[model samples]
Target: MSSYSNDNTTMETTTTREDRLGYNNNTLKIVVGAFITSVAWICLLFTLIVFFAIFKSGQLKKDTINMLATLYCWTTAIYEDSYT
Candidate 1:
């Protein structure tokens, strides 16, 4: 047998435990997250619909296409500049 020395080893814990002094740890995060996400999406959709209603019939489509084109051009310019 060998000597039981405590000089070359640590004296720390080897297990993990959660502490709940006065709170609940079993929360419905998934359900709440899904609910918040769905609400955000619905709000965004309604905002888009209201925006379209405010503008002309096809104005929103035209504006979105124009913005997308501008974004594409900007990305391409940046990419070309990076290669130089």
Candidate 2:
């Protein structure tokens, strides 16, 4: 019985070490993927909100250069989103 208990303890310790070293775990990958996806979504939402706010303020219409720049930025943002 003592030998069995020792074997169980050793197995638990090895598993704990592997987990600490970030080996053999899909859980970490899933967590990192979730975090990155949430951040990307937040960035996309923020960009859209800012774009609408600028549009509503009439800044895009008043300045031709600014309008062009805004459009360029928005295009690049969309491109980046698709790329990611």
Candidate 3:
């Protein structure tokens, strides 16, 4: 029989306290990356929706376009018009 000694315990880079909840450094990185990618996709979808909505409406006036642009910037996390 082989003898095991806990005194010589070597630390595992992966087996950490954070890994208990699957939120280690690597896990956090992956989650953040996925979130950023999803956000980008959502932003693209919103852009396409707004574009189609604005162009498809032949009755869109100057005021309507301005309103749409303002709303788009706001919803897209852009700064207020006063800051621009």
Worst 10 residues of 2 by lDDT: 1-10
Give per-residue lDDT, candidate 3, residue 3.
Answer: 43
TM-score of each: 0.36, 0.47, 0.46
Q: Which ten residues in a row have the lowest lDDT in candidate 1?
A: 14-23
Pairwise lDDT winner, candidates 1 and 2: 2
Candidate 2 residue lDDT tens string, 1-84: 123356456422234566668776777766776666666577667667776887788876657557546765765565455434
Q: What is the C-alpha lDDT of each candidate?
A: 0.54, 0.62, 0.62
Question: Which candidate gets the maximum TM-score versus the true structure?
Answer: 2
Q: After superposition on all CA atoms, how large is the RMSD of candidate 3? A: 7.6
lDDT of 3 by residue, 1-84 (tens): 234457787544435566566565676666666676566557657766877787897767888778767766654553222122
Scored by lDDT, model 3 comes in at 0.62
Query: Which RMSD values do the candidates have, in order?
Result: 12.2, 7.3, 7.6
Q: Give the Å shift of residue 37 in candidate 1.
A: 0.4
Instruction: Let me know the TM-score candidate 3 reaches against the reference structure.
Output: 0.46
